[model samples]
Target chain A: MSGRKLIALWLFVVSVVVALMGFWFMATRASMDYWVMAGSLILISITCYLSGVHHYLTTKNRHGRYIILYGSVVLMVAGLSIYIPDVLDLRPWEIYTRIPSDFFFSFFMLIIGILSSYVSFRPFHNFTKEGAQSGAYYIIHLSIIFTLFPLFLIMFNIITRGMGGITWEFLTEDIVSMGEKGGVYPAILGTLAMISLTAIIVLPLGVGTAIYLAEYARKGLAVRVIRTAVNILQGTPSIVHGLFGYAFFVLILFNGQKCLLAGALTLAILTLPIVTRSAEEALNAVPGELRDASLALGATKWQTIKKVVIPPSMPGILTGTVLGIGRAAGETAPIMFTAVYFSGTGTPSGLLRPIMALPYHLLSLYRLVGYRDVEPQAWATALLLLIIVLGINLSAIIVREKYRQRF
Target chain B: MINKVLELLKEEKACQRISLPPGIKAKTSGFSLWYGSTKALKDINIEIKENKVTAIIGPSGCGKSTLLRCFNRMNDTIVSVRTEGNIWLDGYDIYDDVTDCVDIRRKVGMVFQKPNPFPFSIANNIYYGCQVNDMDVEKDEVVERCLKQAALWEEVKDRLSENALSLSGGQQQRLCIARALAIEPEVILMDEPCSALDPIATAKIEDLIHELKKDYTVVIVTHNMQQAARVSDYTAYMYLGELIEFGKTKQIFEKPREENTEKYITGRFG
Candidate 1:
């Protein structure tokens, strides 16, 4: 090998070794965090610096890019290892003195290594084609893995941990002894009731608004204002919707009682904008020629919309309905303040009575996670809820595909 | 084939004025239309005789379709469209204050360029107009009659419940004609009805138009000069929102009155 290529190769080897040591020390010797973190930072920084220098010397060599890849990876390992222990902390430095020494050292080493390595990579500002390609791949592949890993891991963990708790008795029986035993049947029933009620309230109004926007109303100031209001309502926090339901529906509308109706109404408000926007898009997709053909046949405006336009756009509207129902099924905050019944004395009956919902029940039981049986019940309830939401989303996609075929 | 027909017609009628036919079914006098600020049809004057196909032949953007739409006040659908004139139908001014827009449209059904079949069973597509217009009639009788009149009954008779969109392009356009006939309107306005069809489909539509003239006053707008000659009895030639020539199909084709008409007829820069 040429002398420059040998140097680049040597730098790459050292970087790999440094990244492995840093990852290992961060995982295994977390208690000896100061030395492990500081040692990793110092070693990886040296590897990054050596790779940069080696890359500069072998600019014309094909292996130059391989050197840049090692330098970038060494820096990535150093930063991740440093930030691992206290990733949840939004402000690490402010609580540095209050935190344990191990956390402080790791955070400190992470910050220093990130700063020094950033400077190390600055020399190759105009990167070679191969280096940028590998660099782009690292960013993208790492992002997909990191983003999806936790979601899949949580789902997998819930399935494995919760499947044992699921039984016919567990699903069909009512809660007993403060949810330490029995099943979540009442919560499941209550959740389904609330979802149906929400669909009942939102579907007609949302579709009406969509039809008016798409078919009747001209593009003007009034329409623009309504569209903006819908967008803002969509972005409004669910907690705010919960609070609104509590204040308006419970206090004024229903004479100060939290019930299934109030909770469903709140969820309807949350999903109304989603339904309206998607349904409007669906209605818009109906061909203009169809409308023309109907009107030309001496059908009135309403008749044209009813007979011709609505039938073709039904699948699209149903897709929007599925999406709205899915969102309503999983919503926690809206139901919490207005409907959830955790420790009620007697059996809750009718729409006016407070009832148990899976999301709020999950929230309540999660505090009792120290108990043995409570943990499994909580996981199983979560699994059930996930399955419901996933099923609705899958059906929405299927309906949308059918709608495309019709057009 | 149309040019040859015009040649024979010229020899038969030697310099005689083309008289107005027996009865004028629909006439537009002092008719003008404006879209927002631009005039689309200017001072249009024309007569549609009864039991005949009146073809409006013009280049694109020459207001042929606009003038045809004016007969039923279909232009009222456009918020920016303004009309100032008289459109007389059956000895009554259709643009009068008492004229119901719905009534005008009911009396005058329309067929479009593309075959739009409502994505429904063929039987339902024919029955919808009658149902929506509140016309109480025997559904099966009307369906069979209209389909036969359009020459589509034999092919679609067995599968009346099948979706109209599932038919071939030619069948769909014929079905649209049958749909127009189901309402049994006095006038039927067709805007480039055969434009989206193949030669065979176009031939079928042209033949149907000939049969329809026995009952309905058919006003058609066509870009193809040959289709105009093949289907229409009276021809109205328009250019740039102005009616250039209004005469029998023979006069318009054989011996032109205006230089502009001759140029346009001979395929000089439309």
Candidate 2:
């Protein structure tokens, strides 16, 4: 009916012809399988061109013909996939696991997105809302792929490289060969002990500071100074904290002994600001009307904070604490400078004694980079560290949910 | 509508016929309140009779709420607020050095304009006042008596463990009332208690207020002049941090006490 309509019809016919030719080439001329992938690129254009013709023919009516053609194309792809149609060399999973398929997967997605976008941008007769939205759809599709790539690649690499070192024996036995050929039992126990003490040291102190800042402290000079000080503490690097722990706790407080208490206290100081700030935000969120209601019922300031304000803010407090613990778990610098040793003696026996920790164990293995056997052990150690942090976070959420007020 | 009107009229007659004790339940003499340099309540004097409802009606920010807060010393919680006056609650000057605000607050319960229920179970919210104060009453009896008094017992009896926020807005207000009642306070102060409610819920709270006046001295601050006339035996009209008029509810509504009071009630300048 129109020049645009004629061109759209011609493009649709050309895409179908290309796809048919490519399919024939794949089945008969098996050496030229690259044509099959080019066919999928053409197939994406079919959804685009059909959608335009659909709108043109229907105007405001349902595009029955367009939907029917679109369904057929999707079904055709599904049917072909069963026959192991190697679009972009996406062969059967049984065969492609060893192949470097990342680039091909990304490339296929890009080609499909570009073709779909071209189709979606076509108008029925003139510019419309759907035509205007097609550009946005293409960008969103690409952005999603880009965002997922790094996460997918990292997780894939780690799991494949790390799982080999895991065994029942590896988890339960102590270091026997200068950190190489044994379980991380003592390190695991040390991490647990240090973090347990860290939690104990931080909760009362952090929550108390949060309460004072959020609920009790007036917005005065004192509060402003304290807030600035907290920001400064958070901005300081981990290595600096580790150095300070060495200077103050190891030398001055514990008389030059590297102990679990010193390391745990160092971590406590590092996380206190995060705990206080997030907990403050949570406390501030409890509605002022609720506070007034409590006060009217004769609950004093401290009483209201204890009962009404603190209970609801516990989830936020625990979340911040969990995040801090996650950072603490992965940090080797603080523990290395203050507490951890390359080897251990009976789980350190007490907080006063030096002990091995997971992160430090990993660092020790890294020093033995000449030994090829230690590389897998390093990867497994990292994976275990991730699991340990994730486990702590999961349990914190469970505990937080148990106490969360359904406000 | 007609039945409700007739019922309200009947209740009004009953409220009028029942003789109020002439004894003063609470009084503020030469009371003035200031938030920093800005005065909130000018030198004001008012008498609250025992077992009677006294309504304070005014435009927004007319110091009506400020005066209501004075009865229970609820204003003491605010920072940099200065008060120069003597407020006596049940024969005790509550602002004197020997007086404790906590003790004062425990004896004088308050219901806020918006329903403010703690995000706890219904039973817990109702009994929180008693438990926190460590009152000697049995928990079950306190729950039953207070909820029944607030006219919310039967509706919530089966679901006492459900979260209080799950209740309807009016139910939450009634729950707040029950919460106050649980403490068995001698005086109950309500600050625009029905402003956030719909007409039907407003009617419910008004009815509960009428029932509440028999045992507790009730002081309510409302923007609705009609609400004051419907529920209170006495009305105090305030404007711009000053007491414009204080008289019997009928005399204040029908007769001229002050020109400003007449203008406010007749929909002139607030």
Candidate 3:
């Protein structure tokens, strides 16, 4: 094997070991030994020197040159700091001796390990196709790892902190004393009712708009204007939608009463752009040839859209609508002003009455954290809200996969 | 160029010794089409004989397919397309303001260049036209008759419930033909029907065209000269949006009528 390949293998092994040790220390909170720190420092300096050599061998005009330069300078500073007191002839009482924390040692080892491995795997002097490909593959894998790390951390934190509050009773009762004592059955029911109503209200409006845009509308000023309006609606904040619902649906339409209908309408408005855009995409995905064939077969425009166009796009339409409904289920601001009550309302009785929803209930519980004992219930509400949203999204994916068309 | 084309038409009309079968299924007079600002067809006039195969032959962008689409009013779907002409189906003015495009399309069915079957089962693909037309017929009977007419029954009869897209390209085109036939149209327009198929599949479609002309008037647009000669009783040669020549396919291919027609048929020029 070439010397470069050998060094690559060594770097790979050292990176794996250091990463595993870092994870272990993070998990166990174990203090690292002084000798281990000293050994890691020696390894880091060697890695810096080897990376600098590889940088010189590869190319003079590359980004890796600066990394190696900075790495060596940082290593020099760390080395000089360790001997500064002895060189100045200062007593132990006069100068403070720094002790390397486990996190710092682990972090240093990780950075050095990444630098060495990157320097080692890269070509020594000339650029070949395989070298570029391997470099791309390494960077892509690193990116994937970085991307997944935050999601895993978030899920881990939520499950660990929120799992204790989930009991059968907690799931089946009502909130008591500002959400300090009881369960969240009413809130869950209210959330389901609101989102279901939102889906009902939005599906026809959104899909109708999508059909008009995709199959009927000519590409002219009217279409461009409507498309621009939909895009602007999509980019508008949910809070603005909430405020609009509060002003229009609550104050004007309902005479300033917060009601379930107002909340659903607000959420429908918020998700309409999403559903419309996706449904239009879905409708557009049905090839024009199919429409032409239908028209050639003597089917009228409406008949062709109903039979030939809609069936193939049904999966896409449903997936988009379901995703929009999922967003509606978790949204807090849209309902806070228009529909939900913090307590007292047991469950959804009618469309005209305000009801307690999970997101709003969670917000209420969070507000009462120090004044009352509602932290566990707040975590539990968050967990429940997450579950509902994820469930809706999962079903959307399942439906999409089940009914996906080839052409 | 216009005078030369008119002279050829005049000469051909005067020397019409070869007797053709009676009955005009469709005709166009002073027909022209435009796509936005670009004129696609110019003063196209031809009579498609009933129960006979008429092939339109031209190079690419020569408006052969455009003329065929005008027969069934399929060009109406394109928003930017504008037409200034009159087309008649069965001696009735189809382009009249009172005429319904749906009824015209029912009388004139079209098969596209590329096969486009709905994302449906093979049986449903055939039944789709019948269902859309609201024809009160037995589903199995219509499916069998149409599939047999397209010569795809034996291969796909046992798997009628399978998705139509699972079929090969040749089979899919035949299925589209069957779908068109299920509507029971009096005329069938095919636009480069074999362009996307293999040689064997092309031959099969040519044979199918020959069989179809016994019952329905078949108008086909093709780039291949030999396919036109093999299938069409009458051929119309178009170039650059003008109908250069229209006559018996045998005479057009074998004898010299117009220099441009002879040039195109003899592989001298498009």
Candidate 4:
């Protein structure tokens, strides 16, 4: 290797080692002496500076050089403030001392590692198009990691904390002593019944509206008005939908009774816009040439849609509808007012009967946290809700991959 | 004001129709079409002879495809399109208020420029037209007859259950022809059907057109003048939405009638 490349490689290795030490400190919550922290910061900052200079010499691009230098200098100055506070005169020495040592060390190490690696890769790429492309790939991969990290963290936290509460007896029995014990069998059944009814009500209405909008409706005032209404409906809060369902379906239609039908209707209304918009997109994704070919073959407009357009777009429509249903399944606000009771109602008995749903039951368990031993049950209910929603979403993905049409 | 101008042009062009021979399967009389405000076909008057290959040849955007689409009322699919005057199929005005467009389409089949096969088995694609038309027929027999008529039976007979989209471009175009034939329409309209095919595929389609005219009346829109000369019995040359000349293919290619026809045929100007 050339002299410049050799030096860059050595700096990259040192930066990675420092980063690993920083991670160890953060993970174990270890306290470091002021001298050790200061020394590590200085080492990382010098490594960053040399690598940045090496990249600048090779590529003649000042952007990466200035950025790396700026990051390293800021970290070094911050690190020095805790040790020699009067030099920068930015903050009181007491304030700098109060800041946790591990947090500062981890943050400094992360920045230095990122900067060093960027400069290390730059020497290899030399700021060519391929270098820019590789740089873009790295940024995108980092962004994906950032997005998935929080989701996985939440799932891990829930599964670990909730695992103890999910026993066979916990799943099959009714609530005892205000959910201090017993399972959520009725709540599970109630949730299944509500979502199933919601799907039945929403699918035909959403798919029909989608077909009309995509196939028959002209791009005029009526279509524009309908599209705007769907957009507004989709953005409306779930709480408002709950209130409206209480007033309309419960008060007017059911003679002041809270029922499963009322809650399913509200959810159907809540998810209608999602299903309609997605189904319309799926229908529109079908190429116009296919419709033309069908029409040119002496098939009527309706026949052509039924035979040619619907078959290819069915996968997209189902995926969107399943996603909408997944959203409907987890929603607590809309059903709490119109459909679910706190505890009295066991599994659903009739269309007009109120029932205990998982989300509402979890809410009740959360309220009884201090007075009763229900925290584990609350966590278990949350885990179950997550599983149901994720399961529905996974099925949608499977359906899309299985039946996806090319043309 | 546009109607008055069209009426005047109709009178001026009345003498040109006098020389047209018999066996008129479809005819357009002073038929003009506008897409929104843009006129695409203006005062087009031509007669399609029964059981003959009639080719419409002109430069791009000259209303040759528009005139071909008018025979089956296929242009009705475009929302912006507006038409005046009438197109007659088998001596009946197809644009009349009482005429059912579905019924008109059933009697007249169409093939498009690009091979657009439905995402179905090859046999199912052929069976689709019959199913929609409510025709009770032996499925195997109809599939066989139509494929044979399209000259694709031997090539695709074993793969009848395969997706039509799996076929090669030439095979797909021919499959589309077989699908069009399944409904048993009298007149078949082709809109630049071979434009997307290779030279050998184009040759196959041209040969199929020669065999097709013995039974079905064929109205083809083509950009290739040589194909028109080789395949067509009657040729119509149009320019800027108006029919410039209509006569035997030999005369249109040989003797001079209008100056525009001579210029376009001689490559002097489009």
Candidate 5:
């Protein structure tokens, strides 16, 4: 091996030795908080080893070495604090004790650990190209891993606790009884109705505004101002929008009616920016030459935009719409002030009546934990919400891919 | 065979250098062009004729393409650019108060240097022009006839429903030609049509140009003097956005013309 390769081998050996020593120190230590101490030592040993290896290897070249070192250090520290127990702590199998930490730990651990694992498995060799590992790829892998594990756990939990009560009576019966026999049919309908209404209000306005901004808006002060406004809208927090919806749509416009329309409108505002940005990008991606060619053939500007530009961008626009739907369906904070109701006697009869959404349903179920029978219902609702979000996102991505192939 | 064509062109230029016949009855007078505030073409005067192939030959920065674009008013789409030109087509001023650009484009069609076909069926590409011009007649017949006029009907007839992009470069140019012809424009302006095609495709386009004069007036800009000689009925030599010479193609190619036009045609400083 070359001197550089030999140095790399030596550093790897040193790291393994340190890790082994740290593991031994923690494993043998009788202290109650040895898990925390051992975890930190193990983290430091791994960091030192990896950084030493990288520093030696890149003595002549430095581009991404520091980033990897810093990233590893961060992950190591986070891993130690979150998961590695603070001294052989023993606890009973309470769902609350295991649930929150498990959710957060695996979420962070699987994500950072996968990346660190990949780096550990495939150290940056001289042959690999730079900037090849992108954020989108990382997010996609992390999402799959995080989404699947929780989903599997939820499914297992639901089957063990939820299957017996998932009959037609449990599903179709009303929640008026405030007990085990009450069904979720009204809640389900209210949620569906609100989501559908939100889609109706958002699609035309979102797509129209996107088209106008992308195709018609000239590059000037006003256009720049409008673009900045849209960006601001996108960055604004959901809770603020909920407050605005409650003040305006619920209180003033509908005379204190906190109905489905008010909630739908709030969700529409929340989803608009996402759709507009994606649609704008898709529109911008259509080659200028296509538009020129169409116009040169005597088609009007509107005609060119309609026939040539929009058709090609349809897949991207649809993807944006799907993403917006996903956000709207999962949004709870905005709907809380403007739409959700826990004590409705029955399903909403019209647009003016208040409704229930799945996220709000999930949130409210948290309050029913003391009741034994209602616990199963909450888990089932949680599982259903996850299913809906995942289903929408997966199908949208698939459809977008199919259309991309066509183009 | 190449030498023979060159010699014929030289001999023809020598004999008819003294007297030149005016080729165009239509002319653009006091014409000036601007892109934003920068002038691309100054006030220029030139005339073009009916049922004749006129070649505008110039070097890279000479604005030959710009002049051709003005013929179809294709430059109108550039928002910051402005023009003050009186272009007359058969005694009707195309830049006058009554002129609609859509109508002007319908009457005076254009083909770009690059072969840009829509990502659609070959039939759709051809019919796009016809439909846009509101010539809503029998679609297939129009497509067939325009294809025939472009001398591309035979090769593409079997694949009318196929995507236009699937065709060869030469076929795509011909498809663009058929597209222009589908609108039945009185004049067709081609800017370096052969620049992007291979020798065989260039020759095919030359053949198509020869056949095109039977129906429509054709204006082509070319760097190849041989192409100008073989296809055009009239030739206008230009340099630095100024028209240096304009005459019959036979006369311009053969006789003792201005020294500049001669030096250019004789493969001197282009």
Candidate 6:
């Protein structure tokens, strides 16, 4: 038989072995502790099969099919041992959650897996071409499907939890009471203010430095130093940045006080290198031909930059800003140092008054979850925070897409 | 008496081409240029007659584009670039310390080789140069006159509001030409303007060049020998950053004075 036919046969045999193993795993007691391991094995087997590596590695004159069968049996035994060392030790409560009663998914997956593996690995007898008709495209499609599964799970979780607590009051009213009735209005407003101030500080300084490096300054010791500083800045940990922000902005600048300005300033410093590097890349990406065209058309260097280069780089600059926002919103350690706690009366009397943020609020709510008074409130707050962050991220993507359509 | 008659005929023929009365010259001077420590153009002297096409033909890296850029002081923007030259335009030394490079550029507009129309409407692209240079003009009249002068009014009349990028490559180049013309420059420098265009588009540009000589003194750098011969009145051929020959296009193509020029024109070496 041709190599293609042999490979196809190997794929079929391997899928059958995996399907059998999955069946064995599902058929075992529902009180098993090896659920994660079983899940992982199933994923690995599917990954190998779909990627077509399973066929390539095994079956020497159908000897490879035997290796898969042996490997799956060993894997299934090991997975069972790892998850559930002793069936006698299994708890009665664990039985309910551990074993899924509906075996339809496993069975359905087995059929689909057999069909797909056979279809993808099938040999073409009529074509004169040597070697397998490259399955790299299918392999990529499988990889994408694998990656999308986790993202889909996350989205589903977010929507199920998030939509429950999201409301006008949740978005706009301040968190007045301690538990459930309190809203994230102050936290939302605080985040907006923090981000806006960060932009105000970062944009000019970052863009100016980028311009100086890209356009004004020559490649020398100073430029190298600046570039190194920027790379280091980008590599610095968020928690380390939090420490620096506390030590520098909160303590040194404001005399050991946390204020809105302090938080914004810290975030700005954190965002500066990112913005500079991104803006420099954007500026560099502008074709030299465009600049030459503008200059030849009697535009001065400044005029050329303002008219041609900036407009083309706007989309990239916006992307950098979005990434910076992502970093700013998710950070809890920095806010813990610089700005935490929401005043109950209303929005901060001034910039100096401390403000609450969604991430910290979620953390507080999570800490209070065991308490009867705050458990529901905690869930509601977590849901609201997720919604806000998601909204910001999605809008940024939309804005970037709008500009990309022009190109 | 016979010698005087011959001289009179020669003067009359020069008048028909150059247009200026006796003793009045368009512009001529010593020009030396540098990019950092590297001298690009050295002690070059040439006269550009009013209302005539002067083609600068040379191999790559010979500073043809550099010399073209000097007319508008575009090199002034380069921090390391310097010039020890006298470039007089209408009896004014353009490189005088007080001369504004911006104003000089407005007067000496340029069209690049590849069509580099702004990502804007055709109308906006044409009006931008004028709006930048002459901001006080009555908008409609300026736009109409400039479009007519560029020979683009008829073709682009209906689609003036359309994006410049939506036009064909040749049309974009013409829009770029219209943009330069709108500034009402005394000279227009074209740096291998048709190099990026198709043959038909190139032919259209050559025809436009013939028509442009009536109102603008055009200096073009072209790699196409046939293009230089067909379009220009005078051609200066350079090699390795040195001027090898400067003469009528007919003489440069038909009977070059320099051996190197002969070799280059004969496709021996670039």
Best by DockQ: 3
lDDT tens readout by residue for model 4, A307-355:
9999999999999889999999998899988998878688799999998
Q: Between candidates 1 and 4, which one is better according to TM-score?
A: 4
Candidate 6, residue A49: the lDDT equals: 42
The C-alpha stretches of model 3 lying farther than 4 A from their native spots are A9-120, A124-127, B1-22
Candidate 2 per-residue lDDT over residues A97-153, each given as its tens digit: 432223333344344434433443444334455644764675688579769988888
Question: TM-score per model for chain B alone?
Answer: 0.91, 0.91, 0.91, 0.91, 0.87, 0.87
TM-score of each: 0.79, 0.78, 0.85, 0.87, 0.76, 0.76
Residues B2-63 of candidate 5 have per-residue lDDT tens digits of 99999987665442112123545457888888888878777788778878899998788888
Number of the candidate with higher lDDT, 3 or 5? 3
TM-score of 5: 0.76
Candidate 4 residue lDDT tens string, B44-135: 88888999999999988999998888887888889999999888777678877667778888888999999999999999999999998899
Report how far off residue A18 is in candidate 6 (Å): 4.5
List the global CA lDDT of all models.
Answer: 0.80, 0.79, 0.84, 0.85, 0.74, 0.71
lDDT of 3 by residue, B152-246 (tens): 99999999999999999999999999999999999999999999999999888888998899999999999999899999999999999999999
lDDT for each residue of candidate 3 in A1-407, tens digit (9 for 90 to 100): 66545554665566556556655665676776544644654564565456556655755645445435655754654464444231232346676545445556555555655554454455332234565577677768987997999889877877777889999989998877777888998999999999999999999999999999998999999999999999999999999999999999999999988999999999999999999999999999999999999999999999999998999899999999999999999889999999987687898999999988998988888888899888888888888888889999999999999999988
lDDT of 6 by residue, A125-225 (tens): 21122213444445567569769978897777766766667777776776766545667777767777777777888888888888888777787899999
Off-target runs (Cα >4 Å) in candidate 6 are A1-135, A162-177, A342-346, A371-376, A405-407, B1-43, B76-88, B91-99
How high is the DockQ of candidate 5? 0.33
Q: DockQ for model 1? A: 0.50
Clashing pairs in 6: A33-A83, A34-A83, A58-A64, A59-A64, A60-A64
Return whichever of 1 and 2 wins on lDDT. Answer: 1
lDDT tens digits by residue: candidate 5, A1-76: 5544354344334434434443344445422343443353355345545544665565655544654565567446
Predictions ranked by lDDT, top down? 4, 3, 1, 2, 5, 6
Please rank every candidate by TM-score, starting with the best.
Answer: 4, 3, 1, 2, 6, 5
Better of 2 and 3 by TM-score: 3
What TM-score does model 5 score on chain A?
Answer: 0.68
